[model samples]
Target: MTTNTEPALHKSLGTLQLWGIAVGLVISGEYFGWSFGWASAGTLGFMVTAIFIAAMYACFIFSFTELTTSIPHAGGPFEYSRRAFGPVGGYLAGFATLVEFVFAPPAISLAIGAYLNVQFPALDPKIAALGAYLVFMGLNIVGVQIAATFELFVTLVAIFELLVFMGVVSPGFSVANFVKGGWSGEDAFSLASVPGMFAAIPFAIWFFLAIEGVAMAAEEARDPKRSIPIAYIAGILTLVVLAIGVMLFAGGAGDWTQLANINDPLPQAMKLIVGDNSGWLHMLVWLGLFGLIASFHGIILGYSRQIFALSRAGYLPELLGRVHPKFRTPHLAILAGGIVGIAAIFSDELITFGGQTLTANIVTMSVFGAIVMYILSMASLFKLRATEPGLPRSFRAPGFPVVPGFALLAAVVCLVAMTYYNPLIAGVFVGLMALGYLYFLATRSRRAVRAATAV
Candidate 1:
């Protein structure tokens, strides 16, 4: 079979840059979205859920590294599933990844707008969100090295700001404040609390949603086999610490309920310590934008690469596959994803359901996509291990069946919980996937006919 020829992405990323991409893609979760879990699960309940979700990510990343190092494809899970289960599996994985990478940005962009609104209360958040999409999309189209360098800078600053937040709020930290209404309703866990904890699964998963996107950069990494494992391991450890620390300090600062359901949770938590006019609060509002920007910018890089790979493989429009000749980046793919995000930003008020804003709904939808991709990717690992035993693997998944088994089982539980709590949004996700599958079937049939006619 003849394959499509496409321009190669420049190979300029090293371990540090790849680590930046991996962590930066997810750092924003420490800023805002996860706080919503407090609304459903409260402090103690959410913490329990977060720990479970964190363990699942650790297992998933460890096993996922094996596939990334073995194949080193920009398609990531899509390529792995295709090799293991053929075209149908590839289509499902690719579409799920696209849903994840594409939906996540609008949420981050809205958070960026919310942060900017803290600095300039009169500015409309949607307009600021639109501006963010424009600036970062242009940056990503310029070059991979330039984009990765900027991601590293912002990620480091974001990490520093988080540490500062912990230090500044440490004086007010009290175990009593954190444990008040710790469960969903009452102080202690009960049958009622279980539903709330399950409903909070998506919010907990948000902390590590796009971390797997690191695999999308494997093709552009220098010495991918060595660097991919290092980046994935170090990146997860960094995020897990920051996620737990930030959540604990913020919850203890004041009434945890006040921080729930808002995009500027950090600034609000800081305001409880220093007055609203204090320099510390203002500083957080300013530097906090870097965390949102890092994820916003990095995910744009991620989604574009997914689009480029799928298009190059004859799954999406060919225009999206073309790399810019001068810049050697996926220009059209970047712009295409940006357009979808901008439209979602405009629909912020229109898309709400169950009293949650567009940001929360979008976050749930993105988590749904990520969980599905995790299941398929783990299944691919088992299938490939059995069928292609000779495939060169620089790094092997430790405990093989046990580790991947736990990851896959956890992902299934999360999916069931999310679908139950979010029936409407879940339906929308299913509808989108069904539409994409129809396109895949139509194009595939045409390709088969053309190949036979030429023969």
Candidate 2:
């Protein structure tokens, strides 16, 4: 219960709405991005990577729920780390969370634009991406209830569409298709496949990347102690099932290679089964936008809250902490994050490194931030358990020590794997972090001097 003078977030979100936000924050992965893993590891190898990532998420979310319930702040990992380790720890967590939330939306927005381009051949995907930013930022600013409700609707539609896709493609699914050349160009697992599996770590992570973002909304949850655990537990379960189902079904529907490296794999897989002009294929292209929209919109919500939280704590400029007087939303924070996302969208073609597009690079960079934050958040959980034994926790993580320890270990392994596989992106992530840290130190020193003068 860290109190602040800034306007508070509205408590309109319940368990179901929180569940929606949790799922919506990550549903886009079910649409695309994860397919790139196939290019690295093939279907079977990627599946193993995905399952490992899912287990990490399951443990992380269960453990993270205790922090969310006991502390219940919009800063999420930032608040937890700050409580555990002080200002520098808080700054690192906040910066990483900001990077994760801000960069994620651009990737999803570009995907939204690509999905739109399939329907409108002449419309520039960049323009569509910018338009999406404007629309969703406005929606988020107008009100949280409206935004959360819309998120729930789109998330439900997105889930239904995924189910529809699996059913339609099930008839075409075959074990032979899925396992053919599945292990990094071999039919069975071998030591040679390990590199591909490691290479595919980032994509496997994409399957459940932003689910922890639900903690960012804990301050707005009506009954966080009870609602959060239920929402988080259910949300992770739902996403794990969908991620596995979508990957397996799509891979088995046709030549798995055809689905790999493509943004709209579901439609392409369906086209193989039902012909090019099948209504199902067309429907998937159109309705699939809901998945992208859900993630894009929900991430806007997440980034704004993180920005607001950090600013309110004096980690960022005070202007961004202000809630809209009428709307009770972090309007400036929302707009600030939107500007960053739009800039990334516009730079899609301009920013290329190692033959990867801005979206691909940013996705890796975002995962870099997420893994760092996960490690710190788990560390904070362990620290607090030892230091603050009296903290009220409505739900404790099952199998503590072992569970969260596994999560921490997995996150560290993922970070090492990603850095090794994506050296350029890793460098960029580190560079940005260094710049942010410099700013944090400068601002903190100034604040300390001012406090000393007053004393």
Task: Specify the highest-TM-score model's number.
Answer: 1
Cα deviation of 100 in candidate 2 (Å)? 0.6
Residue 34 in model 1: lDDT: 96
lDDT, candidate 1, 240-275, per-residue tens: 999999999999998899998999899999999887
Pairs that collide, model 2: none
Clashing pairs in 1: none
How many clashing pairs per prediction, in order?
A: 0, 0
Candidate 1, residue 406: lDDT: 99
Whole-model lDDT per candidate: 0.92, 0.90
Candidate 2 regions exceeding 4 Å error are 1-4, 445-455
lDDT of 2: 0.90
Q: Could you give candidate 2's per-residue lDDT for residues 62-174 as a string of tens digits?
A: 89999999888999999999999988899999999999999999988888888888778799988999999999999999999999999999999999999999999999889
**TM value for model 2:** 0.97
Candidate 1 — which residues are off by over 4 angstroms?
A: 1-4, 446-455
